[model samples]
Target: QVALRCGANDFGGTLMEENISRAAGAQYGVSLSVEEIRGIIREIGRIPKERNTLYEILE
Candidate 1:
């Protein structure tokens, strides 16, 4: 929430099995579900956007 209020806007979805952070041993687990991400963003009064591979908005 602090990050969002401070103008940070790049939020990501679930990481795939071949994700880099997982390969690099990032132990972040099960905390970033889609609903959780949307809830977090909503707490700061910002709408969450779903984007495509080319960074185009999908929803």
Candidate 2:
């Protein structure tokens, strides 16, 4: 959420686990659901999108 407000146009895909983050001392098993992601984006006044394998935004 902060990242979007801070000018992040793209977000990393939904992660099922946070292995690297855990190693870096971030909260363990960090994950967000699609609904949560959309809510966060909307909270920051932006729209959420899903990309296809070719990187095209899905409708």
Candidate 3:
């Protein structure tokens, strides 16, 4: 959340096997489910959208 206040805008989705962090031995989980991400964004009063590779909003 502090990162959001510091101007981090994009939160990546849960549609992939994000094992690179675990491969690097990080303690956190690899990814968040899409609904979880959306909830977090809404908790901070922000809108969440599903965007395409070209950054077009899909939802």
Residue 19 C-alpha lDDT in model 3:
61
Q: Which is superior by lDDT, 1 or 3?
A: 1
Candidate 1 stretches greater than 4 Å from native: 12-30
What is candidate 1's lDDT per residue for 1-59, written digit by digit as tens? 99789997765444344354565688754446778888999988899998876889986
Residue pairs in collision within model 2: none
Task: Residues 1-59, candidate 2: write the lDDT tens digits.
Answer: 77677887655433334475677788765677779878888987888888776779989
lDDT of 3 by residue, 1-59 (tens): 66666887764433455665766798875666778877877888888788777878995
User: How accurate locally, in lDDT, is each candidate?
Assistant: 0.72, 0.72, 0.70
| lDDT score for candidate 2 against the true structure | 0.72
Candidate 3 residue pairs in backbone clash: none
Provide the lowest-lDDT 10-residue window in model 1.
Answer: 11-20
- Residue 23 in model 3: lDDT: 65
Once model 1 is optimally superposed onto the true structure by TM-score, how far is the C-alpha of residue 13 displaced, in angstroms?
8.5
TM-score of each: 0.63, 0.69, 0.65
